[model samples]
Target: MTTFYAGLLSPCALACAVALALTGTAHADDNADKNTHTLTPVVVTATMQDSPLIVVTDPKQPRQPVPASDGADFLKSIPGFSTIRKGGSNGDPLLRGMSGSRLNILVDGGMIAGGCPSRMDPPTAYIAPQLYDRVTLIKGPETVLYGPGNSAGVVLFDRNFERYTQPTLSGDASLLFGSAGRSDQNLDLRAGDSTGYIGISTNHTHSQDYKDGDGNRVHSQYDRWNADATIGWTPSDQTRIELTVGKGNGDAAYAFSRMDGVQFLRESTALKWTQEHLTTHWEKLEVQAYTNYADHVMDNYTLRTPDPASMMPMAMAADVDRRTSGGRATGTWRWGDALELQAGVDGSVSVHTHRAGGPPGSMMGYYKDQPRMRDARMQDIGIFAETRWSFAQSQRLVTGVRVDRVQTRGYTLEDMAGMEHMESMSGVDAMAMMPAQTAADRGDTLPSGFVRYESDLSRSPTTFYAGMGHVERFPDYWELFGQHVEGTLDSFRALQPERTTQWDIGMQYHGDRVKAWVSAYAGVVNDFILMHYPMTSMGVDYASNVQARIAGGEAGANYDFTSHWKADVTVSYAWGENLTENRPLPQMPPFEARWGLTYEATQWSIGALWRLATAQHRVADDEGNIVGQDLGPSAGFGVFSFNGAYRIDRRFTLSAGIDNLFNKTYAEHVNAAAASLAGYVNTTRVNEPGRTLWIKLDAKL
Candidate 1:
């Protein structure tokens, strides 16, 4: 081991190594074929990268620290990703220290926007990771093929449906039981013939409040479920059509909010068609349309008793809903064997509405009866083209460009008193405090593009890549209409669009017994929209554009010491500077590292993972995005975990794990501050769950 690796070997990590060694390593069969690859039953570290810029992972695979419940949970397994912890679930996902619309999250090529103005329900909250076939992440602003303004990156949750030649029925099911009353059930089934196929998927998960290391209960509990169906027609080898429909509902209790999420309802549908080999040069053409809806409700009295000493010392409820519908059509063409091009046009429209009833008790029963009023509307239309050219035998050039016309309209009426009340309740002035009765509609034309070069080394099994990308992003609903300027009421007209120019470079190495990759990025952001929260009751909240600088890198390596034993390590770090403020950007994640060791045989596997994080001292207090603000400097901590999986037969498998093996209590730096709720202890930040034991059973048919 290198000296740097020796320096990182803490006592907890040593203990993990000792424990794993004492348990004995798996025995490899000498009669088995040496070239036949075996999948690790338990994934302990970061998933492997498919390329220098792309990461692909199986969402159905069993991973350490228990399987994920939401999209944010699943993304955390990848380096350069973190979650803004908001209780147990429904937390916002951050990539390379950026949140909100900067990170474009797409489900099966469709976008879904959350309804809550407070961000109680983010886009990933409605996603159940296990239901998807695969998750793909494109790091940095390296591509414009998807939607616009993906300055941070793009995460895609997709499913694949292959044509069946004969009649077939296939399915997979899983059941889980864990400590703290956690349980989950999932089923995915498909029946198909040569002409058509039908597929159904369902999932339900529930968890009770869990205690921290000190046996203190953290108000983090949730119940969620989802059901989806798909119908596909494969008339020929070159033609395919698919239709999908899905819906889900859930409720969650939060330790970082005064109100609890009482209801989270989602409805979605999509239609897709594709034709391949249309002409000599035309490779394929595809068209897709999708619509998604979210209905979210938050209340103070539904999950727990109202805190009498808080700002809102009475029963209150706010219901908000958003409907987003969009469509895209793209054509792919290839020229001989040297070049390929893809072009597409896409558009979307979103409408947001809300209704609320409040006070001590009078509005409790009538809240749902009140009619909802439209609050805001947003629209986008974009055209994009991407191309790849194989100029040399070992070198390739890739480039893309996109242009989008974005528009927004606000419906909030001028209400000074209501604004003051909202400030007292949420510590932020709302859009109702507009200077005019209603803000005029605003629109902007933005452009984004990127260029990259990739090459394979002559003698080494390594690929080197470098890229530069630029993106112009318009202000979203929360930045434009949801917040006010410090002393100005015309925030809608004051916030300017943000522009980012970034450079990303990386290299990947694939060897006979070792695999490794490293990626790094740096960017200069002009007009970076930042939100400032109130420090006291007399203070006011505001949003302003500022200059910023960001840089980060992630590296991981896997080594197979022997036929059955393997070791892996990963490290990630991100840094940001607010040039306008001349201070560190708020909510930047701290330096983190993970060490994993595993032993695998033909039928079973055992693994150990030790995660470490460095304390963050560079923070701009009270400044951040819509998800959360930095409270102050946070202390760092480490956690250790162990997992094991056994394959009983081809039809069934069992997996189990002990998370936080030492029962260490810790909180993440990029996290929401704890709120003063009625029953929960008021901590600086919401702590993670204590030691947890869980078991899972998977069956394939």
Candidate 2:
């Protein structure tokens, strides 16, 4: 072991490390089923990169260090995913090397749009992982059953309140306490008779600012809560209908932005119906409708005292809201023993509004001067078809296609502070970039599709596959309307749609005592949308189109030795470049790997994990996403951690862990620099949390 490793092993020096995603180390008894037990290491069931890629798993299980606090935090456990951290919670997710609208996310098959133009609340921010029954990640632009604008990938969070054969009652709950005033509580209760049922799920989390390995406060504090209820009617064994309602609220302080979110309120409602076995050929049918709304408030004085010596020396606040509604219908068909098909049509419409004002000794008077303004509205309609063909017992082929029509309307605020800040320009066509006086509208048609082939090894428990896919995405509201340059051009009017063509391949193997998988992908993008960091123009980044190529892969392996010992390893890497500019793609994460070891017994388990990253010398300064631009280069780092658990009974389990065993101060490459306390322009990315300890209890009945 190197000096660093040696130090990490020492109890006194165990100080730093946290991406919150530790190794899914195996700590199972001889007969523990990987899927049912939350205490065992999480298994990564891989598929070909081109396989319309879907990885489905129970989101309620405990894995790695512990359960995630939010959707973005939960994604870190998956391959080819990372987060743009703002604090302990509410990090924005990044897939491959893409951010923003590139990653389309849906909750219970519904779109929940964030109100912040700066992404203070990403789609995932509203998520409480433990409340969802299942989490699925579909990589690449392979399939488009979901609404348009997902050139990078799609994420789905769902809960299936299954009916009961007879009268039944069940529920699960968990409680957690950790360092730095960390605490969490979650509960899920369900009951149903053959005819109907009602259920509810709720969760809460709170934490204070945590210190870095060097004992420096990171300026991150947050508290949040979410609650949801569902009612279902089972007309017959083959038919069902359900209605769901949910509400969430929270407040958070961030070191990265000038202001903090004083309020994040969310509301959602959905109704769905399903029918099964209509005919031998038609296996099932499903219909769904939903509405989601988000209201947010950001202020310099509410979460933290405003620095009188800094920019906007006076207190300021902004309130923004977004409303979205959509519906979908899908049918599943089976043809003989050789084919199965699913076809669906879905659509969504969204509208945004904003208001802002400042400085009054009396807080009640500030809002009187702020006027709410309508900004943007968008609607999309899509139809999709997917099928699987089985030519042989061991071979299969999967294919899918989709087309989407989208329309966008904008009411550009001409008298806004940013618009009036710098209206003059020396270069570029300015007038052509401006929108219509009152409102503007644009429309486009997009198409996406994918195909894949898979075959099982004739002699082993193994599978391999290869596939190709193409996707065209329309410009999103942020890409087109949020990014504006001084006198040069309105990026919204200048930015072009993005088109991507890609190939993916990979393999998976399972043995008596070992399991492994590998996946890789490469793609070429035409008019790739790129966002440059904020410059002299204002606080907003500039979006432009450029030709680009991207490649990446992820691999993992696990082995069990005897009944008491097990080991696992995983690695992920991503690469990209702007072919038009001949420069490395900005905001790419460095090559990373993780190793873990565990010991287990009938009632107790212990484990350790070491996370490692390669130095990223790759640089493309002043260019990146809305959250951050690449800041030259960052050094590699490794952090160690330890965990243990005890099962009290079939209904209860207790676990605890020490993260960043050797509090080694480190920062990720994909991060935004946080502002300092003195109101100074601190562009240095915030350091991750240092050594921390936590304990949790899981119970069910």
The candidate maximizing lDDT is 1
- Shift of residue 684 alpha carbon in model 2, Å: 1.0
Candidate 2, residue 292: the lDDT equals: 97
Please list the residue runs of candidate 1 whose C-alpha ends up more than 4 Å from where it truly belongs after superposition.
1-40, 358-361, 413-436, 483-489
Residue range with the least summed lDDT across 10 consecutive positions in model 2: 17-26
* 2: Cα error in model 1, Å: 60
**Cα RMSD (angstroms) for every candidate in the order listed:** 9.2, 8.6
Tens digits of lDDT, candidate 2, 130-204: 898888888877676777767678999988777789998777677778988987777777899999999877777
Candidate 2: residue pairs that collide: 14-661, 14-662, 15-662, 15-663, 15-691, 16-660, 16-662, 16-663, 16-664, 480-492
How many clashes show up in model 1? 0
Off by over 4 Å in 2: 1-52, 359-365, 413-437, 483-490, 534-540, 679-683
**What's the C-alpha lDDT at position 388 in model 1?**
95
Relative to the true structure, candidate 1 has a C-alpha RMSD (angstroms) of 9.2
Q: Report the alpha-carbon TM-score of model 1 versus the true structure.
A: 0.91
